[model samples]
Target: MDVVKPKNQRSKRALEKRAPKLIENPKTAMFVRGGHISQIVTDVMTDLCKLKRPNAVLYRKKNATRPFEDPTTIEFFSQKSDASLFMYGSHNKKRPHNIVFGRMFDHHLLDMIELGVEQYKPMSSFTSIKSSVGIKPCLIFSGDSFETEPNYAKLKNLLIDFFHGSDVERVDLSSLETVITFTVSDGKIFMRVYHIALKKSGTRTPRVELEEMGPSLDLVLRRTHIASSELFKLATRRPKALKPKKEKNISKDPFGSKLARIHMTRQDMKQLKTRRVKGLKRKRDTAQEEGEGTESSPKRQN
Candidate 1:
């Protein structure tokens, strides 16, 4: 005798079992290359740190090793509790300037959970992950267009502010193409812009790719990377409307003094007087009752 099975039930069971296995072993991982990639990752990681209730780790490799080789992995991992939005950064010497950004299918940090390691353990509760990845800092700029000298200078200043040091040696510009690349140290972070242009014809809005970079950074430079974003023209546009000045004769009454005055007319005063009279009458009645009770009470025996 043969047992009959429903096709959909079997499919669902198979998927449930296979999903975990796939997550346990991810097939495709992000890869970063070039000298500025490390800095890009650093900047991105810095921003990730700003998230609330976040678990982030940053680590550098002790010994240099080849890419995809054992003992050569440097990585950063970040996750929120019970969330399937884990962000990972992986790097190695073979890809010295190469960095990889990845997300767990479930974003639950199941790899650590499976290993029985608590999220961001052994470090301060506020500490990000301590990975073996080395640091490479670089300047990143985004704007509507870096084509003009002034615009380029503005972008340069923004980058200078972002990296903070003269260590930024390579500059990658993809603003015109709505893309940005920053390479510093041994890592790189790439950003793709998405939004309205700040300028009518020369500005752009930017969207920081949080998941694309492996880690979070303190400061990430996301300029208006569009060709015509309002912010792009903000540096050049005239104000459409000026704020009105306060009138010297106008009183600053938050409680609407005019309305209050209107409500405090003679009729209102009469009603208030009536309320006070009633309140006093009630008080007098209470006093008279207390006096009568005192008089009626028998004198205490000596």
Candidate 2:
């Protein structure tokens, strides 16, 4: 990885944007296509940029670069654009309608996965309700393979970083109008984007329904570059300030209520020294009290 020395104020600001922080900025992505691309590849890139609007950079002209052979160009672009994520599409005779999704760590290729687009339907094909641009999407990864299989797990992580949108502290149901579901089955990934429908549930919480919006795809997994455990751990390291501090004898419940343990010394019931009622007193003390009361009352009567 080559580091760029900032010469001007603008370059310094750009470098500062890439610096690690407690609340890092949203990751930008550069979308590039090879010199030879098919209609499907074009449509796929277009729809993806639509989904990742404002944060994505679309190259108008085609470029001749193979990431697997020489990734120097992509790395340079990553640094130039200040984009940590990228999507490259290429349609060749050998591999038709191919798209490579990748992530950059320190402006260098950390993960690059080749996915062969088998069946694709652009968002324009579906004339249904579309989500508003720049709205954060809810990502769901389903199927046992995504969790159980190693390759699928890496793919899952890549997809999440690609479409996670802006980082936020809170998530409400109203903001979750868009959902992108990725299902892995039979060694193929099925991707579907849906617009959430909130119906009248006759309560505060609305009934939720999923309506397929578009850009549906069936992708067959191809070559991949999954980072090693050590490298991945390093890449995923977070600032200590952002990490939740461990609180001893404290915990949180489902509703996020703070719960803490209260330690107290054992109490001795006998040492309470509370006053007792005359009816429950000892017989000798009770008799003396009664005799004194009778004597006082008789003298007053006389």
Clash totals for all models, in order? 52, 0
lDDT, candidate 2, equals 0.90
TM per candidate comes to 0.20, 0.80
Error of 1 at 248 (Å): 72
lDDT of each: 0.32, 0.90
Error of 1 at 90 (Å): 4.1
- After the best TM-score superposition of candidate 1, give how far the Cα of residue 174 lies from its true spot, in angstroms: 26
Maximum-TM-score candidate: 2
- In the range 25-106, model 2's lDDT, one tens digit per residue, is 8999999988799999999999999999889999878999999889998999998888999999999889999999999998
Q: Candidate 1: minimum summed lDDT over ten consecutive residues — where?
A: 113-122
Candidate 2 global TM-score: 0.80
